[model samples]
Target: MTMQIRFEMPSDEALLLKDMAERFVADHYSLAQRSRMLAAPATELPAHWPRMADLGWLGAALPEACGGLGLSPQQVLPLIEVLGAGLVLEPVTPATLQCATVIARLLPEDRASDVLAPILAGQQIEVLVAGPDGMEPAVSARPVPGGWELSGTVRLVPGGAAAAAFWVAVDIDGAAVLRVPAAEAEVTAYRLLDGQAAASVCFDGVLCPPDACWTGARAALDAGAEMALFGALAETSGLVAALLRATLDHVKLREQFGRPIGRFQTVQHRLADMYICREEVRSMVQLAAEAMAGEASDKRRRLLSAAKVKTGDCARAVVRDAIQFHGGMGMTDELAVGHMVKRLLVLGQAGGTRAGHLTAFSAAS
Candidate 1:
């Protein structure tokens, strides 16, 4: 059965993107392909960078002059969800679009075009900057002579070691986008629990020159948080789908007593509950994306926090139920469901834990 979620009715551009993503998944996300990539030393990204760039997806949130699709959030969420469904590991979503937006706004008009062009083209990788742990975008940087020196580490920096550059945050000093040179910065990279690349970026006085240092730390922080939340939600959605699909398949195939488990009333009820949880979380994510695309600053902040809380709740419960429904296999790595559970557990706290988001929402109100 086709699931009906609020985001099903996305903008025309978003619909076009959905079509592209559908084709990409059908062609590239076969079980064999995913298994092969998983067996590789690192999670696979494929050539999604250049190919997605050609589709104008890598730059969907940037300006036309900057080599972007210049698309809005309403036009981008569907694409992101498609990426999530496939569990693709490309660094394009937050690394490029989210980070590029801040750089475009903070950097000189002339320079933004140059800096953002490579990002859109998938030639350069940028990291989302944030700081002050327990808060959104937790990390801090400082300005030094000739350039800004990024201090404190952005733990679990996505593609941190692999990324060619970064946009880091530093306390009330505001946010500054630093073009961190790989050769110059010391990076410790590893695969995250979900098979995504993560690293601890240490800057022993890494210089972010004036031209290279972009401002507007607060605004950037907000945007980055929203991007991150969306990523978490998308990932959670994929996991939820996997859990529900597996449950449905199990009920139809497995037998209890003399009949199929699917005929069991209790089993049917459990599956229905699972579907409800998934749909509710999906709706929250769509509303969050739409709210982010809105113009009101206060409203946007409030909506994001609400979305985070709702997503966290539904995701946590869905995975737990999936575990219970699957019995012992749910906790084993031999089963892909376990990985989804772990990822959702992490997502619940990534952007901000439920309590943290609640407090932030309260304070904002």
Candidate 2:
């Protein structure tokens, strides 16, 4: 008996958005531009953030009532994949998707419109500061006269330096979330190895009104983490795919033994292995996205962790092989592969490490 392997096709809208993202990246986002942005002073988002808002990409996963497209997470994966391939340095996952989801889902109805409107309009940037592995809250909150006072430090917040506001996870009796204006905290910003900016924010007696605090923050944080993981997986899949393409192109042009290196059986096998890894990661990403859209919370958490582990392992493998195939040029700044390898390394550590996710998956089981 013969078995067939099937791949799910994206929806028509997703296909359209994917094409738009590709064209946008090809026209506006390039390796040279990425390099320039990385070298620039860290502030909030790129100037193209407004353009992304104009294209409706910022609100792709938000509800229509909140000025978003009301699309599911699966529909937004294609755009994320394209952004990843371009190595765009925007904080789509940690800021737009994750923070937006938390605000939309957990914030009070009256406050949602106030927060989500500006964000969806690209007038504000917000970064989520949740603890890793769902452990203890990184920040703590105490009740004050009119509201809550937050005190603690949140480390390694993606895009935190440039954010206009922060969604901080705090323990006030239990897990709670607070929206603290960036001006209220001390932000120590630095760039990651991949040229992305992050920060350590210290909230020293920052006062937030009662309306700024949201209850049931644990569930919201879990959901936000899952969403962020899905976005990261999509981006990593794109990065792996781009690496494979670059490696193939390099092998085809670079001569070894008076012929293209790609003609060698050993080189061909290595390229094939890289391709297989990319495909596996891509499939797992899609599965996780689908689960996030439909599955129950417990099931979604398990699937997201499973996807993160698989994606991280495959990403490391693919990046390592791609670098090896590129010879000495792979590690140089002149080539994009070296930069991609750096991004993959960061992604592996983001959200949760592979070993950590595997442990989470096991515990869940």
Candidate 3:
């Protein structure tokens, strides 16, 4: 009875979105642009932020009334590939996929707009800090007379440096999920290896009002977290594609011996293996996306965990082989290959490590 999803074709809307995204990447993004952004990765704001909002990408997952396409995680999944391939650093996974999803799904219609509207308009950047398992243990929240007080610091918040606010949660006995304004916490900004701005936020007894807590959403945190995990998996799929393309081009060129190195049997075998890995990742990603979009079940959880493991292992192996094929240039920032590898490394560990995801897969099975 498990794994009954039929192989379906992409809908018109999904195809159109992919076409539009391809055009956007062609027109707006480049390796040189990524280099400039990489230099200033401590700030989450990108020059194309407004453009992404204008295209409704930031709100792509929210409901139609909320100025979005009401796209499910599976429907909007193609956009993640585009962002990853272009090396765009706009926090799509954190803001669009995670926080925006939680706000739209959990908050009342009236209140959801307050957070989602600004994000859709590119006026505010909100992110989630819920850990791999429900809530991060580093943060502690205790009930108070007026509301609640939160202490401790979370060392890593992807895209948190420029986050206008954070949808934070603590692993405690109650509905601890709530929004905290950036000013209320001390945010030390920095850059991730992937050139995305990040922060370590220290919340010293930050007071959270009763209205701020998402008590009803406490139980559904896992769903939101899974959506983000699926996004990472999708992005890594895109990165694998990029690495394959880059490696192919390099092999075709850069002559060695008397002819191109690509003519060598050993190089050809590696290329064939990389292509197979890419196809495997593509198939696994689709299955995982389908499973995640279905009703909540142990089957869905196991599929997602399997996907994380597959994508993570494949990304590492292929990227390593790609660097070897590219010679020394593969590790240099001058080439897109190296940057894509770095992103693959970071995203490969987005939800969980290979061993960790394997454990999850086993538990779910």
Candidate 4:
């Protein structure tokens, strides 16, 4: 019999992680906490970082040799799911997993140890570039006395403002992925809606030794895209879950015409539909994660695109219904629904907009 993919409960270990994460969010981070953290100086997330490290979450996916638990992708999925439910913010979602996967798959063997070690150890913060929308390179890299000088623009780098370094792709003369130092490169930063920091980097006469150059730019980009898709799926899953819970809560006590609004057939049907959509989106995300873990490249790509399209549609629909169900209060920032909708909308378009993905899917087929 073929093994079925279970989208619901995870293993004991995953459950333990989930419980710990949920408790942490309850104790240390509510929506108020999120707002406070965002307003704080340095926007430093120190409290969260150490707690995550202590929980061994920082090293969840890396190999044992690199100070990680070496868990399979299946194991990591639950942890991310729990994070989604809690609406937690940490670099592990996109920055660590995506960057670490790129290093493991694309970087030279000699470089893997160097790159993954610090990340697993939680000593280094590496940011990945999403695209080149608003960035401009200052210096061009060319053969030098003993190394190379990199000059150019890398824009919309996630976590770039605080990154120790960046996994940058350069259109070297025409192409290459260059591992460059954030300290050496000048970067301008902007805040994302979800309170994450991103920046545009300008490289001005930055010196990169021969050791800094890595082959497999195209492969890394492809892998990065997949990683990003999964991250987005994970985040969307969180938003939908939050919406469901809030809507359920509102329905329970919200009275209309001498009965709870939830008692009405219409209200129940809307909620049931929302629940089904959320569950379906969850299944698609899980399938995409499985395909990625198996290294089924073509299958992974197709599944990721499919998940994005479906999830995007579902998110838009679910949030719209949620707002209508909750009435005007749902649209206010004080409530979680509005913020969740904003995030879902941004993420839906982040990796590749729905229209863009559809076009790509058509072209590929």
Candidate 5:
């Protein structure tokens, strides 16, 4: 039999989480609320953040031993997709899955708990500025009398303004990670194109105790990167689906020649193309999920890179076509399509540029 790729049916737990997330979005995360949040300072956490924690969202992906639910990657993918459809503002996956994975699996048990507890409770955040940038991991570090002195500037770190600590990758004989508290760095806070909180963090001879460093964190870094890739792909796929649905509804209601545009042959063709784009992305997300389930290897990296690259192209295609179908209304800031398009624009380039990921894919191959 020929091979087939499809979205696996979500587990009961994932279905439960997905329903909860949809309910949460419907009950609280309205388009109006999103607009208001966009108008506010990006550094101020959204009002619904604590509620996400209270609903067990923050601890959903972490292991019970690490103060998390320890759900599998597939089990959590639907929740991310649903949140993406709603355009939820919180960095739930990164703060919960990616950041927590690094902190819990790499740091000392006691220290990890200390850092992760507040994060899981929505009381604090920690971020890595180099997320999805695919840059050469760089944070200059040297042994000092009392500890290590680090010097480097990481720019445009998402969530950095509110982060309590930063997981900065350093080259010490090999790849390593330093858990530096946000207080130790000079952070210049700003907002991204998609209205996410961001900052440029600089370390000038910042001292760190030996206990704060995790040597040979290349594995930890790889694991974190995998989770980040999975979350981005899944979330963007959700956005693609939502945009497709919105565009479909618009076409059916829009009129041309005294008839619904969706009934016309041209609009029908466009909608079909958009639907195909959506399905392509959905398939790639499934591939990402499967790749994440396996071991961290060159093959896994290559597959994730391919999915990332494909997801970027398809997200843009759907958004561009959706805009075209909306007759310029999609471009208006007041519309959800406008905001979704902007977010997709950011996601399309933020994690890994097409060229960057292309190079990565080539190397992996």
Candidate 6:
């Protein structure tokens, strides 16, 4: 007798959104367009930002009360994966998922709507400065009668150059987060190896009103960090999948020893290994996404760290193998593999390095 295994599928809405994202990428995000986007001024996003807003992609993860579809992290995973496959250079992960989530969840109620509305509409960009330096209760804040003067530097802020504002963490008496206008800070912008924009923002006596600051933002920061980590995992999954497909295509087309290189037993074994790595990454991303939806913070952190470490490992292996299979051509900019490899390197270091996550996982246990 034969047995059948059944699994749950994504909702119709999720499937529709995934298909729309894939179609959007196929039509709008060609390699040339990606290059143009990278070369454009740091303050400008690609021309498609407004179009993405129109498609409700920008607001997909926000709560419905915040003018979004309120999609869960899991539901948004497929769309992120699609973006990854196309190597989309937009700051959707940093700006929307991480920064927006923090603002919506922790910002003062009176300030939330005004700040988030423009972001969801794609009219403004906000970046989070909550990495190690930003998280440290070290950014000095001095009382200046009605408001506080902030003086510190936040390094390696993703999407910082184009950001209209920043959710900056600071220390008054304890940990607090301040919403500071980008104009107030000295933003030194540069391109990451993956063609993404990053900046080091220095706030030398930047004044911030009391209303612009929120105290005890650690919980919110944790939530945003987890979301960012999940976004990286999702994108890495898509990148690995893309690399696998490209590798398979290359093996089938490249000739060696009077036949397709794919016919070689060793090549077939490598291809199989790549596929295995891709699936492992996908599974871990799904696990992390599911964990994020639950209320248990400890469990969520543990699982997210596990996912980050596994995804980084798999991404490294898959990219190395894909490049090897493609020979010298893989390292050239002419092919997508090299770009994907750079992105994998960036992603590995973005949320937290594999060693960092491993330590976190061990501590969590």
1-365: candidate 2 lDDT, tens digit per residue = 22122335788998888899899889877778878777777775666777778888888987777668888877888889998888877787887778888777787666676787777777768888877643347888888899988888877788787899988888877778888899999999888898888888999889999878777777777767777878888999889899999999999999989999999999999899898999999888988877877777777778788999888888988988888989999979988898889988888888876787788789999
True-vs-predicted CA distance for residue 213, candidate 5, Å: 1.4
Compared with the true structure, the alpha-carbon lDDT of candidate 1 equals 0.68
Q: What is each predicted model's overall lDDT from 0 to 1?
A: 0.68, 0.82, 0.81, 0.71, 0.80, 0.83
Q: Return the clash pairs for model 5, or none.
A: 62-70, 132-351
Please give, for residues 300-319, the per-residue lDDT of candidate 3 as tens digits.
87888888888887888899
Model 1 misplaced stretches (Cα beyond 4 Å): 1-8, 39-47, 132-144, 171-173, 332-335
Residue lDDT tens for model 5, 148-212: 89988877676676677888878777878878998888988787777667788898879989888
Model 5 worst lDDT run, 10 consecutive residues: 129-138
lDDT of 1 by residue, 113-190 (tens): 887777677675767655422124354555567866665666677656467776666553554455666666777777
Could you give candidate 4's per-residue lDDT for residues 21-81 as a string of tens digits?
Answer: 7788788777898777767543243347656777888767666665667766666777776
Candidate 6: global Cα-lDDT? 0.83
- Cand. 2 Cα-lDDT: 0.82
Residue 166 lDDT, candidate 3, scale 0-100: 85
What is candidate 4's TM-score against the reference?
A: 0.88
Clashing pairs in 1: 130-137, 130-139, 131-137, 131-138, 131-139, 132-139, 140-170, 141-170, 175-217
Model 4 segments more than 4 A misplaced: 1-9, 41-46, 108-111, 130-142, 172-175
Q: Please give, for residues 1-365, the per-residue lDDT of candidate 6 as tens digits.
A: 21121223567888888999999888878788788787787767656777788899888888887777998888898899988878887788888888888887886655677788888888878988865522454357888988999888876888888889988877767777888899888999887899888888898889999988888888777777777778888899888999999999999999988999999999999899999999999888888887787648787888888998898888889988999999999979999889989988898877766787899899989
Q: List pairs with backbone clashes in candidate 6.
A: none
